[model samples]
Target: MKKTITATLILISSCLLAQPVPDSPAYEHELQIGLAGVSSQSIYLGGKSQNRIFPAIDYQYKRFYFQAGDIGFNLIDSKDWEIDFGMGVNLVGDTDRGDSRLLKDLPNLSLPVSGFISAQYKSKMGLFKVKHDYEINNKHNGNSSSISYAAPIFKGQWLIMPKISYEHHSQEVVNYFYGVNTVDATLSLPAYQTGAVNNIQLSVLGLREINEKWSFVGNIQNEFYGDEISNSPIVEDDQRLSVFAGFLYKFF
Candidate 1:
């Protein structure tokens, strides 16, 4: 897997260098910031649940974007094929009285330091993207990687994207947060173990250009995981869904 990731990154770097440079200013920069709150019934970790609020900032320099606060580093560029790198923090809440059915068993699991690196090629017909990510902390260590494709459903208004992903985690990472320990195991509690997860997702995003400065964006994503990972006692349902709506402010 490491070899594959290295090779893919090398190929992307080569392609980036082969493309002709744009004539525009190479040193130009921009900055933008926003705040957002997300409410969900459940974010499953073994048997834990949490609700979260995230505040975010975005800064761009020519072809790179910095994401901090809520979302981490997310870089995108149009001159050649688009490439992205992302890094962020992950927080999980106490499970005692949470809203999700999946989090009823475990309590208080937090995994910090989450991030990804990705690249894409876009054309009028469609776009193809590949990404790799990691989640690191004292208690947990996991990685995820994926490839996806997107096509315009209504030109400037909507898009449909499909993706296939794989995820793996260390035993400590998995067991600390998602598994039942020996003590709990003796009591017949289900344990979440370290393993690989394979899944597919379909996402749809819609955009509304409100004015020159602000725009509204909405998105929905649905995912289905493969049996090996999805069938675990610690695993939630095989299917997962997410919806988000947000406003973007662009500075010229």
Candidate 2:
């Protein structure tokens, strides 16, 4: 969500505009709001899939940028490359087993807000980016790094982008979400800790410019967990996927 936020912002600034804004700090970057529906795994321990509607936002001024729930500033910029420091929140939602015996006794975990540094490069073929985020004010003390590529296909008023990404989660992050601590472990669940480099993803995004005031968007994303995550006793599956579609009206 956060990466796409920035990608859309880049699309707006570079592709949508006929001229680039100079390095003037005084600019009115308008607020862009869009409605979207996102679906994905309910929990990292391999729970059922869940879907919800969320608002997407993206705006930029000078070197500072804000998108979705992330905020950041570019520290380096070339004609086609940039490095930025950004922050986003982690929503470690609650868990209820209900009738699912697979999640019988897994204690609920709290997700904390996180900060990350990201680098990006845009080429005629595609856009490449790398990001690493660390948890703040939480028991999860590790970080995750993601490397992704996005290819843009432009046809008249329609824009399509396909993306692939690989993510690596540190040991602390894996354990915090999927491990069975001694206190929470039962006879069937043994205390365990996971390893690193645990997630891979692929996605495609579509956008239709509805005149100059509105744009329609749709996205499909899939994820496959590595051994560290799939091998967990609490995990039931190794793959997760999501689809999102929405519309945005430009006010400025």
Candidate 3:
């Protein structure tokens, strides 16, 4: 997945040097570098949120688009509807801090990437989007789906979007991250398997344009875990919250 995504990125960058027809829309691009943090309330592995500064790329040329850490290409584009193919990264960071004994002895899981197909529609109410993804690394081999809404405000320069999404974890994924195998099961933590909806998240995204070349972005989200996830002996929290704020420089 990483290789395919990287190659696609290179191909998109090459488009920046291409010469479009006289009437083709001008190229649009943005680059951002800033700090981000996510504070998790999960009790599993005593995990804590992290803060890090990183660079982001937002590039759009005709039907192709890349934003933040995800990249997508439009398969269908029209006045009020669009279909896109996208890919994103999944992180299993900071699994060494929790107090759960069932989790303490477990090995840490590595990161995996996902690829998705999404469809979007715009109406008077707002813009609605839904997507389905699969883990491309075969590590977790998990599958997930999500639906979100976006409402642009202030002539579309500023925006507010509220979204809800649900994620299903494969038995393998749950076992690796939340399961207690027979060999490792103890009196307090028995062997268990999880293979259903494990996470549901609600979030709002806000963006404001400072000028033609500068803008600000912010988002806050709350995630609620399902019984399968919350019931794990390694887990401590039924819910968690995360936030991000950043700025960007746009070009044309």
Candidate 4:
């Protein structure tokens, strides 16, 4: 795990050295509120699960964006130049699990104060975004980071975004979710410890303005992760493909 995290950091550092930061100041801001639900036909932890719903909201001012939902709260601020800061709680699961066994097995499901800094640059050629974050206060430390690039394949209507991310968690973080100290071991449940994980993802997205108040959004994303992270006894699979269809309503 340590070796993988070191290599990922070195690669991202090399990429930063290879590219020159762009000079520009274009700002966009908005507020959004919506409802989200997830329905999956997969068995989790050897049990059948059902679909769930949750409310979501987001607020943006200048280069800052704030969001709150089932996943907790997130605050993102961008510098006009190529720098940014993000801080928030990252709650797992797309929907609330309530008092299910899944939640019981993972009691401390929230990564209480995860913070990271990022750098991003965009121009006529393409766009680049990088971010790194870690736990603020905890016995088990965990950190994660990602870098992504996007370019226009067919101009404004279509685009492709490719991203790579790495995550490292200390024994504390792993124990909270997958570890079984005597209590869990006696229950005959498998331990959930993980060393580190890396993820590579590719996504294709399209935007269409339907009229003054409505717009159409669609995207397909595929993700592949590294072994320690993906092969963990707790992790379901190493790959995933997701498709989303939604309508955006604008208020101005």
Best by lDDT: 2
Candidate 3 residue lDDT tens string, 40-126: 344464554444334446667666766544577879867678788878654322234233444666655555677879887877776
lDDT of 1 by residue, 1-252 (tens): 332222222211211111221222444665544443332333243432222333334565665555432233335566547666656443221223233354444455443455667787867756666766577554466665667666645455333333333334334434554456544453334654655545666656555556766656555555565665455555566665555555666575
1-252: candidate 2 lDDT, tens digit per residue: 343333223212211221112222335575556776655554344355555555666677777877655678879988787798877654222233112456666765444567889888878877888888898877677787888888888788777777788878888777776677888777777777767755778877777878777778777767787888778777667766567677777676
What number of backbone clashes does candidate 2 have, counting pairs of residues 3 or more apart or in separate chains? 0
**Clashing pairs in model 2, backbone N/Cα/C closer than 3 A:** none
| All models, RMSD in angstroms | 9.1, 6.2, 7.2, 9.0
Q: Which segments of candidate 4 are over 4 A away from where they belong?
A: 1-29, 35-44, 47-56, 67-81, 91-108, 123-125, 137-140, 154-175, 186-188
Give the clashing residue pairs of candidate 4, or none: 178-192
Candidate 4 local lDDT, 160-249, one digit each (tens): 333344434444544454444544543445555655555576666555556655555444555565665455444465554545444555
RMSD, candidate 3, Å: 7.2
lDDT of 2 at 20: 19
How do the predictions measure up, each by TM-score? 0.65, 0.80, 0.76, 0.64
Highest-TM-score candidate: 2
Off by over 4 Å in 3: 1-40, 43-45, 90-104, 155-157
Query: What is the full ranking by lDDT, best candidate first?
Result: 2, 3, 1, 4
Q: Name model 1 segments beyond 4 Å from true.
A: 1-27, 33-56, 68-80, 90-107, 154-177, 186-188
Comparing 2 with 3 on lDDT, the higher-scoring candidate is: 2
